[model samples]
Target: MQPALFAELRRLYAAADVAGDAVQLPLLDATATARALLIEFPQASDWPSVGATLSYLADELALPRPALSVSAGGAFTLWLAFASPRPLPQLAAFFDGLRVACLSDLPADRLRCHPLSGLATVPVVPAFDAVVERWSAFIDPGMGSMFISEPGLEFPPNSERQAEMLAALRAIDDRQFARVMAQLPTPPQAAMDALPLAGHFTDPAAFLLAVMNDAAVPIGERINAASALLVAGRR
Candidate 1:
């Protein structure tokens, strides 16, 4: 095993910061306060979108850069480390704002942030994907486009290199987090709250329209539906 691989992963993404001796993979719970946040871009062919999103965060939002990783299952993840544990609710809101801001063309269905779900399992890395016969690794962003078509490493990455990339990443600290959250368009809709749109309605507007008209959907949900519809329509 590349020992430094896990060492770097643990340093940045671990749910609980351990001192000097802990060796287990992060034991994460859906509702637990988080020390790291992962925003995964799932479409294998959309490296341009990933690049654009990065530009939006840096050139526009003026936020610190996150370490990038290619996942075992074919996605590019922007992994943000928090210097201290922070609540998930506001982070979820911030992610939603990013989606609505930059990725309106990309369906939210294909994007992911976690461990925001209880049923989900956060695995140990260099996690193997048996189906694809590939492994996950942190990547240099300059070379990220190469992975779009064949995401994930066929073999393990260099341990020292992995450690360097992870080390170079700057964790978002308290002041930065506050400023970023404040920049969020007041009350960005938590897209997780909107995930229940029934499967039959492939069209998002149709789903929201149905939600808006259905008295059974809570009044707040209906309002959110209308708000989403308005936001979506304007774009």
Candidate 2:
């Protein structure tokens, strides 16, 4: 992990009004490189149900239950330190499933699972870390508060929509993928409307490209936009 990102994470933990002692777990081969997962709740009142859910998931996944950290903020971070390198695709799939199952209904809050390997030179680890770092800041409460407060704004797509978006991206049909991207409730009208250059572009390819390249927008939204464009770009 970059020193800056590590410092930011430490700051987040330290700022928590209430927090539990960190629990270190071995995620890969027995080594000094163990990963940590931190679970933070907005208040002590929210801990029981969230704790129970985490416990249930730990039991189901055969992973250790994460210690709870109560705080005034609503975000939770699951930091995984891998002893050995793992394939990015495999890890992404596992974390995606876990996030959907565990965090689908959580309100105005975010759950992020990041995998870090001690060996930074390992293939894909640096790139994956960059992606996580970018998206982590992109989803911060400061950046997302406006969208979260917007009426009818689907800040995070539901399970059904998530599946649909993923399928559209994987599908070979560019037109179908574009249609799905166009209909998504995220990257709200305000975002799209702000893009005057994209106003004349009705095709999904141009619209998605516009969104992806817009630095004013959140990285998560841009990533989704990029995914749609990638699917469309496939010939």
Candidate 3:
């Protein structure tokens, strides 16, 4: 599973499109290749998409920052490792949820989520694309967009830099993953109450829907309701 985390980055390069729409997803129960998770965006048209997506994860989801890799092609990738192997089906859904939620503008067809197996194309490994004769490796995000036009490098990235990038990469623990998984998108339903969210509901949105729409639930109570939604949101 460990080796497959790197392999998944290569897989993202080949299988770059996985989502169908913004609201409802037909997530593939893609089995795992490793103990890691790599959420890639093949539909990222500009460098800002990369920045926005990263910011959403950091600021909104409060997830551990993932390593970013520029592919042999023009697509960008986000790689996250786990302290333990995660079930591929749940992992797939979790990742697809993030893609749909954070990258809301991405069309249904152009998105890619899961990482499958590919030989020797792992990020930071400096694989040579024979067709284009350029290299692929982990890059500093501050300077990542500059490489987006032509992701492959003419020469090998400095080994020490690559080493530093790899070293800086952090893995998600079970508790951290579980907390975020509580917020990932679920299959659409008629009402938020239908979801098995906190205890009875599958959705925290239902709590908001109930409190926000009810006139009897006063303004001060409404403010408290919004604050309470955080606890309701957790699994």
Candidate 4:
């Protein structure tokens, strides 16, 4: 993190409750502050969408803001908003939606497999490497494109980011990885590598179906859903 960005993060944390406008002047030099906010920031009372979060930041900083686009399908989408003009509100909204998504209230049989289509309605935001790893467990490797699309960003979402996420899961138990991957679209090869045989699932398909059917699963499950996708196909 840049010094100016780190200072801005400290300021944001200290003034978390302060309106955006209150701290805008002091944070102008801190471009990395937005990235840090996505990393360690706590979940807010409401999960504002990436666009909404950006709007909030723009309102706070008094900068020109852009419209946020979200997909209706995958967990990866929630982390895509940061590339937009507003990264904060999108992440906030994403967290809120994830809570709702974890409830598994939607009809699994009726749900289509659109990768990020499910998250299309949710918001996106910038996240730190850790947070990305945390969210990747829910993405289906097959479903998630090797690249992410962001408005105004010429470069696609970093492949290294996804690799880092896979590394994080690899550190956990296979059962834990299976449990997490169950809720996602389809697992990728990289994510599938995170699971240990004999981990929570007897078969990857079982894990995926289990998570899709269990709407009552918690946010942790939703976060893990990203990984389940990979396991399912491998089974």
Lowest-scoring 10 consecutive residues by lDDT in candidate 2?
A: 119-128
Question: Candidate 1's residue-wise lDDT over 75-193, tens digit each?
Answer: 88787778777655556566666766787687645666664432133555555688988998878778888887787899977767777777777777889888887885543345335
TM-score of 3: 0.61
Candidate number with the higher TM-score (3 or 4) = 3
Candidate 2 lDDT over residue span 72-154, tens digit each: 12332323332223433334333344444554465423333332212212111111123222211112122223322221112
In model 2, which runs have C-alpha deviations exceeding 4 angstroms? 1-49, 67-75, 107-235
How much lDDT does each candidate structure score?
0.68, 0.35, 0.55, 0.30
Per-model C-alpha RMSD: 8.7, 17.2, 13.7, 18.2
Q: Please count the clashing residue pairs in each candidate, in the order shown.
A: 0, 1, 10, 53
**Candidate 4 structure, TM-score to reference:** 0.23
- TM-scores vs. true structure, each candidate: 0.72, 0.32, 0.61, 0.23
Question: Considering summed lDDT, which 10 consecutive residues are worst modelled in model 1?
Answer: 115-124
Give the Cα error of residue 104 in candidate 2, in Å.
Answer: 3.3
In angstroms, the error of model 4 at 1 is 40
Q: What lDDT would candidate 1 get against the real structure?
A: 0.68
Q: Write the per-residue lDDT of candidate 3 for residues 1-235, one digit (tens) a residue.
A: 1344334333322222322221111122233234555556564365677788788788887877777777667677676666555554456456556655766675534444443211212333446677878776777778777875666688866766665566666667779889888877753334323422233545667766666445333223343454466457675
Instruction: Mark the regions of model 1 whose C-alpha exceeds 4 Å error after superposition.
Output: 1-3, 17-31, 119-121, 186-235
TM-score: which candidate is best? 1
